[model samples]
Every structure is written in structure tokens, then in C-alpha cells.
Target: MPHIIIEHSASLDTDFSQLLKSIHQSTIDTNLFDASTIKTRRVAFPQCILGDGKTDFVHVQVHLLAGRTQTQKQHLSESLLNTLRTLLSDSVSLSVHPYDLDPAIYRKN
Candidate 1:
């Protein structure tokens, strides 16, 4: 399972719903996880200070069950970053971080 969370500055203008759909689809294209298990959400911060206080940013964090190869994780992150690059403006600071959940401790009810 993978949970994708997008955190962005509120000033950033974009369609979050469409972004989620595109991200979900990109995850599916990887053939790494079940389509039904992919989850995506967004959070916007109304106030934040960035470099010079003028730059807006979008950060995507992806959490997944452990045990995937490093290459796979990198691929996942890069795929998402590429997707963001296409949907967002070049002026926006974008980043993607892929985190691994320990299989022994991670659980779902």
C-alpha cells in the first residue's frame, strides 16, 4: 500500500483533485501496487515563510510498505516529480520524498 500526501502553500493555484487522479494513475503505471490501494490527499498551508518569502512550494510525501528495491523507490519518486513538473509552474519549488514503512510495525485494521 502507498499513501501519497501533497502539502503546498495555499497561494499556489492548481486543481488538487486532478492532481490526485494523475498521481494515482502514475502510481498504477509503475505496476508496483494494487490500484485500489493507492490513496492521495492534499493539505494547504495558508501561511508559511519561504526563501525571500515570495516562493511558493509543493511537497509530496509518499509512504509505502517496506521491502521495495531502492531503484523502485527512486522510480516512484521521479515519476511523481515528473508528473508535478508537467502540472505545476516552473516557478514553483517542487519536491518528492518517498518513505518506507517498516513491514514489522506497520498495520491496518
Candidate 2:
């Protein structure tokens, strides 16, 4: 079970919707989380203050119900970023965070 939260500035283009869809697909392809359990949220950043230089800064927080090996996390991270870069403009910035669940809770019995 992995949940992804996306926050972007209001100035960001509407194309971001497509980007989110792509992210969802990529996550499903990874087989890291149940597609049905994946939770996503997109929020518009306040425009009063200038955004952090880019149309938006994306923070991808992944919560893995099953503990992942280091290699698995690395591969997932790389794949996620690559997919994001392909969908977003070069000017946009992206950040990803992968969290591994505690073995006690995540290990498959």
C-alpha cells in the first residue's frame, strides 16, 4: 500500500493531470503496491507568494506496507523520477521520498 501526495502551485499548467495519471500507471507497473490501495492527492499551492522558482515542486511520499530491499528502493526511485521527468517540463522540479515499512509490520508472513 503506497500513497502519493502531489502539491503544485496554482500557476502550474493543467497538463499536470496527465502527469498524475502517468505516475499512477508507473506505480502500478512496479508491482510495489496494490493498485486499488494507492491513494493520491493533488493540491494547489498559494499564489500569493512566488513558487520555489518552478511552476511546482512535487513531493512524492511513498509508504510501503511491505519492507523493500535497498536495491528495490533504489530501482523504484530511479524509475519514478525518470517517469516524472518525462512527463514534466525541464523547468519543473521534482522530489521523491521512499519510505520502507518496519519489518515487524511489513514482512510477509
**Which candidate has the highest lDDT of all?**
1
Regions of candidate 1 where Cα sits further than 4 Å from its true position: 52-54
Residue 14 Cα positional deviation in candidate 1, in Å, after optimal superposition: 0.9
RMSD of 2: 4.0
Work out the TM-score per prediction: 0.92, 0.75
What lDDT tens digits, residue by residue, belong to model 2 across residues 53-103?
655566576777665878888777777788878877777677777876665
lDDT of every predicted structure (CA atoms): 0.89, 0.72
Measured over all alpha carbons after superposition, the RMSD of each candidate to the real structure, in angstroms, is 1.4, 4.0
Q: Could you give candidate 1's per-residue lDDT for residues 34-73 as a string of tens digits?
A: 9899988889999888884457888899999988999999
Worst window of 10 by summed lDDT in candidate 1: 47-56
